[model samples]
Structures are given as structure tokens and as C-alpha cells.
Target chain A: MLHEPASQSGPDASADYKMRIGVWMFLLYAAIYAAFVAINLLKPLWMEKTVFLGLNLAVVFGFGLIVFALIEALIYNHMCGTHEADNKGGE
Target chain B: MAIAIFLTFVAAVLGLSFYFAAKTKSASGYFAAGGQIHWGVNGIAFAGDYLSAASFLGICGMIATAGYDGFLYSIGYLAGWIVALFVVAEPMKRLGKYTFTDALDAKFNSRGIKLFAAISTLVVSVFYLIPQMVGAGVLVEPLLGIPHYAGVIMVGAIVITIVATAGMTSTTYVQFIKGAMLVVFSLIVTVAVLVRGLSTEPDQGGRVPFYKYATLEAKEVKGALVVNDYKVLTSVPAKAETYVKLEKGGVQTWWLRSDKDGKIALKETQYEVKKADGSKLVNGLPASKDNVLRQNGGLEAIKGKTGPEAATGKVGPFEFLSILSDPETRINTWKIVKLSDGEDKVVVYAPSVKPGNKMMRPGLKFKTEGTPIQKLDFLSLMLALFLGTAALPHILIRYYTVPSPACARKSTIVAIAAIGFFYVLTMYMGLGAVINAALNPVTDNMSAPLLARTFGTFLFAVISAIAFATVLGTVSGLIIAASGAVAHDLMDRYLQLGHTEKQKVRAGKIAAFVVGIIAILLGILFQGMNVSFLVGLAFAVAASANLPSIIMILFWKKTTAKGIAASIVTGMVSAIGLIMFSPSMYDKFGLNPATAPVPLDNPGIISIPLSFLVLVAVSLLTQKKEASAA
Candidate 1:
């Protein structure tokens, strides 16, 4: 009962689909973050320059990352929920 | 009043623990809280468990001391949870029964998997526990007038009782309550900071003059340190010769010293006041009680002194940052310097006056522009903080508390929302501590609580108690993870002891007590170290040892049991081995830190990739054994 083998045709297919979406999100997020870090390492002085209204580049970019994470989470959650809903209807 | 409030909070948590003890009759109830926590509640509990003293005390202290750089930790920590949500959450919930090891061993019933995974959990948990225990010790001295060790032992006893009796059920509620209270109180403080705005002079005291020259007139009399003369620019403040300003090159500054680094350094000048009873009072205060070098406290000048907006009496949130960013602002802050000349070593408590523009930039600490090693150290620290969140054993186990995979995912999003908001509030709190002019000279961890004291004793008491609760909640979660690894994974699963559910629960309780004792001892031993640095080391170890294996098993189709086990051992050993001989460790041991074999303080840059390579190579070699579906 503990080790129920994941069925291939029913819920497994949905799980597989969700996994692919998860991978895609992870990659996109990682790429964007890597760019932010690269800027920090290579040209840290650039980050000190003011970009927004009175705020510097580092503050703007840092807050931007938080806002970016929130958006990604909401999007992924909605997509996965929709996927689950569609699969349930198919059943 | 503070002591009464502290005792009340402690009693409420203990009462909650005993009440939940009745509900835990089986291993499931003790280990995973019966898998019945509401997703909303469990989500916030995740925030409660994750914040620790590091976020509340350490990050704020760093910000109070280092400015914008401290908030970087907040950003890095919160960003790492995205990996937890996107990659680890659903699969972890779907596979694991009680502990993180349960998920790793799901694909293969390999003893090697359980053994190594359990060991990794213990190593990471213990490393994480030291900081929380140390923070507990720090709180005890100021709040209850007890020695550091007594506070550590008190927390150890309380946490062990909570874990032994109710287990995860009690721990979860403690975390939930602590998390909610921390966020609410932090919000209240942030609003207060904005309302009070920025000021050059403290409301309580008159301004002190800034000097430019300081000469520590001391000569070696035989083998003892003797004072010949101590003179500099002086206004003759009430208590004699304890402080002096510098006036170098016609620029009146805050400090003066003989070191090559001519930058302003404040020294807590101590004068010997020998009493008839053989007791000593250095500078009007007893040398024995909490007098770790003293710094002057009154504020000197405001940012805009004579303009239309002079003093800025009270400003809004954005206006606060602008005021701190102004070049005209001067702030008094501590700069610790360890001066060792041959057999005689003197620790100088150097204070400095710095401008707002310099404080709002990076490179005060973690010099990104120094040497190649320093820059690499900064990047490596960021990498570990970003990747370590998903790999932490205690965090991974939280997934099992939820019923379904969807609940697990939703809970993670909820956690992100709450944690993100709290982190944004840390910037204001940390800067507010500086602007409030109540920083604890010796330790930055006391920044938030000391800032609260400026408001009133009630706010101060509440903030301090909540900080202690933060320590308790985190330590309990860590102990639960450690206990699960011992009883469920090591004993029942790996050793094939075949214990009944009741016996397994009993074994877990015993393991919790043992682990709590070990944590208390280590915490006391590693006193005076910053909580954030200790936490950074924990994150590095977790990232190196556990992250690569977890990532590979979930994504790579060719991953075998042997590969996973080898990676865990390699990652754990290499990271810890390097850290054991790291420069920081050498410094901690009172040896020449430059003589350390490993140059880098953080091992994630080296060990993380090495772990991945070992996993891939081992997986290829063991390909003929079995192919687990990804």
C-alpha cells in the first residue's frame, strides 16, 4: 500500500505534464537570475548607478527580482491548477 | 516587566506542547503531525520555521552595521525558495512519508541511500542548530540577567520537552504563532521608523564634538601593558578620558590610531579604576559585567542641518532611504579590530564616523573589489544562499505535513508571499536601528531589540521575546528533522531493526534529546561569532552535500542508488572537510588564519560542482544495476 507504483496512463501522465512545466519554469528563472548575478560580479559599480526615481540600480533590480518571483509563482500555480482540472474532466 | 513577559511567552508555548502530547499516539502523529495541517496554516508555519534568528536578528544587525549589503541576504534567501516551490515541492510531497530521506529512498530500496541521506540530514541540521542556540544565549544575557550557558541550557531543555512530548504537532503551532507575531511586530516597528524619520541628534542627549587626533600613550612596563599618557582632541565629556575625537589635516573626525589603515577607528578607551575590595570599574562601569569596550551614544548631527527641511523631523518610507543616502549625514558605528603584536594581543574597540553615501554601498564587508579570492567568496556565498533553501533537511520534511501535492505547492506560494513581505520590512528595521542610534557596540544581533528599547520597555520586551521564540521554533524544527533521520531512516529502515510504530516514536524522542544536548554544547562553544556567518556556513554545507543529489535524482533518468549515496557522502565530506580547515575556522582557533589550507571560506563553488561530477560518474559506472524512472 505504501509503494503504489505510479500508473502510466492516468494520474502519471498529468504528473509528467506538470513536471515538464516545472522544469521550464526553473530554467527560465535560473537564466534571469544568472544575468542579475553576472552583473553584480562583473560590473558592481554599475549597480550603484541610479536608474529609477531616486533609487539606485541595486535596489531596483533587487526589488525587481522579488516581484519577478511572485509573478512566476502565480503563473505556475494557475497553470498547474488548470492542468489538474482538465485531467479530472477527462477522467 | 520584560522578565514577566518573557516567562509568560515561555509558559504558553510549554502549555501548548503538553496539550498536543495527548494527540501523538503513533509515529505518524509525532513525525508528520498526522499529515493533517491545514495548507494555509502549514504555509505560514513554513515561514515561521525558515526565518530563524538569522533573518530577524542577524540580517537586521548586518543592515544596521553594513547598510544595503545586509538586505542582500534577505533577497538571496527568499529567491532560493523559488527552487523549493518550482522543483522540489510536489515530488517531495508525493514521495516522502515522514522525512526527507523517505523521498530519496522512494525510487530504490537501497540501504546505502538511507544511510547517507540520514547522515546528511544530521550534519546539516546540527550545523543549522548552532546559530539558533547561540542566538538564544545572546538573548538570555540582556532579557533575564542570566549567563549565556544557562540561557542555552534553558532553551535546550524547553525544546527537548516540546519534541519529546508532542513532537511535530507542538513544534508546528509554536512556529505558526512565532511567525505571525514576528511579522506583525516588525510591521509595527517599520511604521514607527517611518513616522520618527531621520535625525542627527538623539532626543535623549546633547551632541559630542568630533576630534581628529588620538594618541594611545602606552608603554610596555616589564611584561604588563602600562599607560604613560592618553591624549587627543577632547571636550572633557562627564566621565574622564574614556573618549576623544580626532582633528587630522583640519578635518575633525571621530577616531585616531597608529595603524597603517589611517581610516577613522574608534577605540573604547578603558581607564583602570582599582577599588579597595580588589574589584575594578573601567570608565564608571564595572569591567566584569557586560562591558566589552564602550562607545559613546549621543547623536552628533542631522543630514540637512540648516535647510528648509532641516532635521526632517519625521519623513515617509522612501524619504528615510534618501536621508540615509545623503552625503552630509554623519553616523557613529563600531569597527572591530584584533591587534596581535607578538606574545601580547590587544583587542581594540574602534569606533568610526562615516558618511551616508559610503554606508549605502557594498564592499564595507564581503569586499567584492578586493582580491580575486574575496570576489569569489562573495559570489560563492550568493550561490549557496540561493541553492541551499531547497536542500535543507528541515525544510524538505515540511512537505510531508501536507496531504496532497497540490496543497504542498499552494502552501509554498503562501510561504513565499509572507516571507517576501517580511524581508522587505527588514531594510527599514535595519536602517531604523542605525537612525535610531541604539546599536549594541559589540554585537549586531542586538540591533533590533535595542532599537525597540528606544520606544519603550513594552515594545522592547515583546520584540526580545519574539526573537527568542524565533530561536525556539527553528531549533525544534531542526531537532524533529534530526530525530526522524535517526529513528525512521537509520534505525528502522537502514539497520532493518523492524521496530513497531510505537517503538519508532520512542526512539525518535530519545534521538531528539541527544541532538538537543549536542546543539547546546556547540552553541556555547561558538560564542561571539555572528549568527549570519554561522548560518552562511550551514547553507554552504547544505547546498554542497544535498542539493546536487536531490536535483539529479529528480531530473536525470540514469541516476542509480549508488550514485545518489556516493554524491551525498562526497558532498558532505568535501564541504565539511574544507570548512574544518577554512581560514575562518583557523581564525576561530586563534591560529594564523592565513595559514589555512583552503583559501575560500565558502566551499559551495568547489564542492557543489564536485558533487555533481561524482554523481554523474558514479551513475554511469552503476548503469547496469537499475534504471529508475525520472
Candidate 2:
């Protein structure tokens, strides 16, 4: 009962925030896929790994992601509104 | 030999389904453990559900045949969990409703967001399901001697029935059961490994090394290796193969079949003599392009060898055996040397899927030529595993099953412990399969079950059944996620199909059925690729498309719903589009990989960051636009 339908929520409910967000995300996405295809073609130095597990010192290194995923979660709760949507359920 | 026991497993799973059928009257009960699972129980269940046919069967099979490189995969997979616990676990709980899309639409209420998220979920889910279904198909063929397709159908039907009958509730509990059993039984097998220990020598009457790659007279085609050429390679070990001995040409040869059929058999084939120092050959040029090289990945292959060279690859006391199964480097592999009648020598390259690689895909792909398939494979897997875990709709829903965020967090902690422990045991089982020489050759997915068979039929039955349950639990979870997209995201969110709670639940059930069908078809389409690798792709898409939007919305005030919507749509679309055009799918769809649209097989290395950057840039530019309108 708390969250109403889009048409029902008030003038603010129809906010184009959704579309705006979608477009931004899509651009970044397009860019990333492009880069991936490019890397395969280029065969950059970092992508070269003589090691056993196929890990590389690539431009798109996995070590950074491992660090980032952990950091993003702990330091920030995805920056969710502790003020507005504070009604989160507890375990 | 294990057909009766396999039948028993199928029966047991079906029996369990009948028991839970009545309780699954509602969609909620079927999909999310009735939102009543305890954090601890669900935690273990999560671990169970996550380990699939790939982990149990593939890794052990790879290690048994391939060597040290096979074990490296296990380490990479286990390492990925650390990323999940610290970064993804808590935030994912906060995102979405029954699907990853729900959380995305919270801020924007955008149809674009809903559509894209649903599409992405379907794409990743279908890709992931293929391996599971294919593995099932592969398993039935050997254990039951049934056709591959029959096995696929059996598993697909059983999984569909399970999801249709018990929904999330049964799935969760079943996962817990499978996870616990997989770990415990594997421990028993590992003990068997230590007890029996490595044989002092190969062909010691009954026992042998994990694998025996042989060719009575192997022939080398362009991409194919044949039997005739194997004879020449083995016949003249006195030739250049044995001549240029800088350190005894590092080659492993076994005597199995001289011909395609067992009609022509040889008792032995000479392998390149392996001294202690020679076991360290990590990389080298193809010895001869025409030499026919064969590998025996499973124990069955060893028992069924048809030639003398079949045992040539077998190394002494501990030099080859010890180095072969190490997880760090893939040294001491059975190199294929294909010999032709007169053309050129050809070598068939066979990679050893390490336990970690089989456990989870490595996150390494940069779209480059210098990059070996292994590096590309490693990156692709890591990308998917890291990103996919949090974005899973079923996993997210598990948080809501608990009483509070604290419970969600606690459940994740428990899950980490259990999953971590289980992954550890998988390594032991993988190594055990090597020494026991009871590994499955072609499909690494059958490693764990075959390893169990080496001990006794009863153990094999239990292990195989647990693996089946593992499939049941995961497939059920995926179907629930897909259904949620249909019912909640597409129907309710997009169409504005207002309905009562009862109606909503019913809609979900129907959606589950449809998704189940879709999963079955996809499972059949992409059969050859490993399941863990497929799952890794799923992870990459989920992480790229869904995770970024959710994280940005929760944390950034500048994030208007518009930014959130855009990011989710982009991430989902781009990742899916890329995967569809990828070489992996192209071959499946009967298209040439060279002609395929997407250049790189994996999209994560680029797609993930693109998501984050878009959110930040758009949020900055459009901050005032939303404020004035409000």
C-alpha cells in the first residue's frame, strides 16, 4: 500500500528519471562492448599472460574488480536513501 | 554399470517432488522457500544451489587428464567469493522485487528499465541453463547408456516439475541438502584418494594413472585427429621424436586403440621419457602439426584403452602424477602428436579444465590475439561470477525471506562459509579423480560422480543424486526469476495489469511454466560449451546491467530515476546483444564465428564500467531537469 502505481503517485510519479537513467546506462554499455571487441582485435600487452591460470595484466584487469565490488558494498550501501526508503525490512 | 543407481536418483527426485506438490499451491511457496527459510538454512542452500554439474564433474575430469593447470581453476573460483561477500552481498539484497528489475524501477518507474532488465535476465538465464541441461544429457548417456538427448529431457522435465510443484521453497531447501551432501561425500572420496594413494608405476596389473592418452597409429586432420597417424608417431619413437633429446622431448603417449574401433589394439605406446626436470614444460611450439595426439580424461577411458601407446603418457613414481594435478601451472600435460601418411604432422590441442575453472569461470578477456584461449576464458568467467552472483533475482529474493537486513547479511555470511568450504572439497575430489583414474573424459561435468563410482556404486548413486538435486535447486531458482520478470516486471509493472494477490501469484505460476519450456529449448541448443563458463557469462550481464543501476540509485542523490532507468536499459541491452553475436552463440546458431557480429566472446571487461560511467555522467548533466519539473 505504500508505493502506489505510476499514474497514481502524483505529478512527480511521471518523472522522466527512468528514461534519463536508461539512456546514460546504455551509452556506457555501448562503449564497454565496443572496447571489448577492440581489445580482442588489438591484443594489447596487458592482455598477454604467460602464467598458468590465464590471468593477465590487461587493461581490463580483474584484480581491480575484485577490490571494487567489495569496496562498493561495504563503504556505501549503494548510496540508498537511509532517509526516505528507510522502511527496509530487517533480518 | 551405474544405470540402476542413476534410475534410483531420478526416482528419488521425482518422489520428493510429489511430496512437495501440494504445498506449492501458491507461487510464493514454489519460488522463494515460502519466504520462510531461516538465514542459516538458506545460507547453506545458497551454496548447494550454486555448485552445479560443472563443479562436480568437469573439474575432477580435467585434473584427472590435464594436470596442474586444471587445479588452477579451482583457486580462481574460490577467490571470486571474497569479492561477492564484501561488495555484492548486502547491496543486492536491497535491489529489486522478485527480479533484478524491480529494484531498478524503484526510482524511475520506467517501462524501458523493466523491459531491458527482463530481457537481460532471460538472456543470461537461457545461456546458463544450456550447460545444466546439456550436462544432464551427457551424464545419462554413460551412467544409464541412454541417448544424450534423453538425459537432457529427463533433467529438464524433472527440474520443471520441481519448480512447478514446490516453487522457491523446495528449491532453497533442496539446494541446502545438495550442498551439504556434495561437500560431505566428496570428503569421503578424498579420504579414499589418500588411502589408495598414487601407484608406483603405470600398468601395475589393475591400477593406472588418471588418464592414458594413446594412438596405435594416429592420423592428423586439420582440426580432427584420426587413428592411422598414431601408428607412425608411436612406431618410430626411434625417429626424430626420440632423436632431438635436449631434455627428452616432453611428450606423453599411451597405448590404447591403433584404430577407431577396438578392432586394432596395442598393448603399449612409447611416450617421451619424462625425467624429473622434464615435467616442468609449461609452453612450447607444436612439436609436429601432423602428429595425432590423444588424451584420456576419465577413468573409463583408461579401462577401455585399445593400444600400447595408451599407457605411454603414464609417468613414473610421482614425477608426472604430482606435477599434473597441481593447481598453479598446467605442466605435465599429455600433448597430442598426430602423424600422417605423408603430408605434415598435426597436433590437436586439448585444454585441461582446472577445478577452479570448472568450479567458476575466470574473469579474464581483453579481446586480443596475444591472449591465449585460457586467459580469455579466465577473464570471461571471473567477470560473470563476480557480477552475476548479486544480480540473481532468486538470490535477491532470499533476502526478503528473512526478517530483516541483519538476517540477510547473516545468511550471506553463512553462505560464504559453506560455499567456501564446499569449493575447497571440490579440489580434493578433483585431485582424487586423477589418482583414482576414474574420471570422465570428454565431459568434465561427470568428474565427481565418476569419482564416486571408483569407490562404490552406493557412493556414486548418492553423489549423482546430489548433483541432480543441485540442478533441481538452481534451475528452480532461475525459473522463479524468469517468472518474476513475466509476472511482476512485464505484466504488473509495464502493462498495469492490476490484480489481487491471489491472481498475481497465479500469473507467476504460469510464467514459470513458460520459462521452463524456454530453458529446455536453450539447454538443447548450447550443449558442448561447459556450464560454468555459461554461468560466468550470465554473471557478467547481470553485474553490468543490473548491479550498477541499483548501486547508483541507493547511494547517489543526484541519481534521478531517469539515470537509473537509462543505465539498466543500456547495460542489459548491450550485454545481451553482444552475447547473442558472440562466437559461442554463432556456432550454435549455425553461423561462422568469423562472420559473427560481436568480435569478443565476453562483454564484461567493457560493459561493466560503461554502466557506472553512464550513471555518473547523466546524473550530473540532468540534475536540474528533474528538480524544476518536480
Provide all candidates' interface root-mean-square deviations.
4.0, 10.3
Worst 10 residues of 2 chain B by lDDT: B239-248
lDDT of 1 by residue, B1-630 (tens): 999999999999999999999989888889889788888989889999999989998999998888877887888898898899988998888778888888888888888999999999999999999989999999888899998999999999999998999999999999999989999999998887787766555541222222222344433347433333332443223212223333445533222233234433344342333455666544335677665443333233456363224566667776676666666666666555443223323333455666766666666777766789988888888888889999999998888777778888998998888898899889888888886676766688888887787778898899999999999999999999999999988998888888887898899999999999999999899887878888888998899888888899899988888899999999899999989999999999998989999998988888899989999999999897575332
Q: Root-mean-square deviation of each candidate, in angstroms? A: 5.9, 11.6
lDDT (tens digit, per residue) of candidate 2 on B376-399: 544554465545566666566666
TM-score of chain B of 2: 0.74
Query: What lDDT, from 0 to 1, does candidate 2 have?
Result: 0.55
DockQ of predictions, in order shown? 0.39, 0.06
> Which segments of candidate 1 are over 4 A away from where they belong?
A1-13, B204-255, B258-310, B339-346, B627-630
Candidate 2 total steric clashes: 125
Cα shift from native, residue B155, model 1 (Å): 0.6
Give the Å shift of residue B374 in candidate 2.
7.6
